[model samples]
Target: MAVAGVLVLARSVRMTTKFTSALDIPVEFVTKNVKLRGKLHHITEKGLEVEHIPISIPLITSIQRKWQSKGLLLVKLAGVEWAPSGMAWLQQELKPKQMIWFQLLGREELALECLVLVNKGRFLSVCLNEEILRQGLGRTVPIKGLPHDSHLHWKLHRRLLRAELKALKKHKGIWQEESYYERLRDRISSNRVVQVNSP
Candidate 1:
């Protein structure tokens, strides 16, 4: 099509469309502009893969510090300070076979960078990554090639930084009063456990 003395390609036209969720909030009226809803199926080196979205979906975002592949995601969610390596815990918390929602922060190659939230009953949703960092389960790191809107992106960056600070202060996640070598050891050890446990 031609408009204002310029020709628009069909490919460009197709890319402009946005996704709206029927399972969650409406498109225009919602505070979060871009959203995706699906089931949590698996995890990748960098993020989570979601299903039932009718498209290729991977949800991940930039962290303040990246996790060195522990091979297994070690989560200490219970009252204790540490927990074993098991996918069952995550699956239970995320609730398998149910539709979950992701608020897209931005886009990266092959997936949408999103805030994965779990619903705490009616109208309340929790960002899993943020909560993880806040509770000292993980750390955050920034990645390159984020969105060009500095204002919006900076806001997200600040939020991640704040979460990291909280983790550091409480010595949560990988920062729990361990030496560098020991932290590395823990990461590797957890992975070994996962490998032995995987069927």
Candidate 2:
């Protein structure tokens, strides 16, 4: 019985070490679809910069403090591409140091494609990806790192399309009509055109 107990303890230690080692590599975490919690650092043209808050594991973390993970992760919203107003909208919606949950879906190079959720109320959470489409601030795009015909890929695609449809119906943001300048320019150009007589 003593030998069995020692074996079990040894296995647990090995597993814990493996998990901690993976934390040190951000790409490993991204490829594994590891959910992370972090504070909003800033917005970038490519995507959001998030300061990752490493998960603390009791005594193990304290001992591995020198090797513990610490850095910003570039996160892009999965299944959506920004429109002209998308960046500005995101800037206004998310504030500095605001706590958010990053549900990683995939990774492309150094950027993690994720579904970013923020607290709406005491018990409510809002998905920023869908909201961006719903407001017409962004358009649906093929989700990277997912198979073209995969079930999960289709599920996310349908949801994003629905959000974009809502914006279209309401004529919001990009869906709205052209500006006055655009209309006036077209009118002036058309009036300047001359008709030629045929021989």
Candidate with best TM-score = 2
Worst 10-residue lDDT window for candidate 1 reads 70-79
lDDT of 2 at 86: 94
Displacement of the residue 35 alpha carbon in candidate 1, Å: 0.9
- What TM value does model 2 have? 0.75
Q: What is the TM-score of each candidate against the true structure?
A: 0.52, 0.75
lDDT of 2 by residue, 169-188 (tens): 88888877534456788887
Note each model's CA RMSD in angstroms.
15.9, 5.1
- Where does candidate 1 clash, by residue pair? 63-140, 63-141, 63-142, 64-140, 64-141, 65-140, 65-141, 136-173
Residue pair clashes in candidate 2? none
Per-residue lDDT over 91-197 for candidate 1, one digit per residue giving the tens place of the 0 to 100 score: 45665445666665534334455556678979898766566667665556552334545576567667766876787777765667444667899999999999999
Whole-model lDDT values for every prediction: 0.49, 0.77
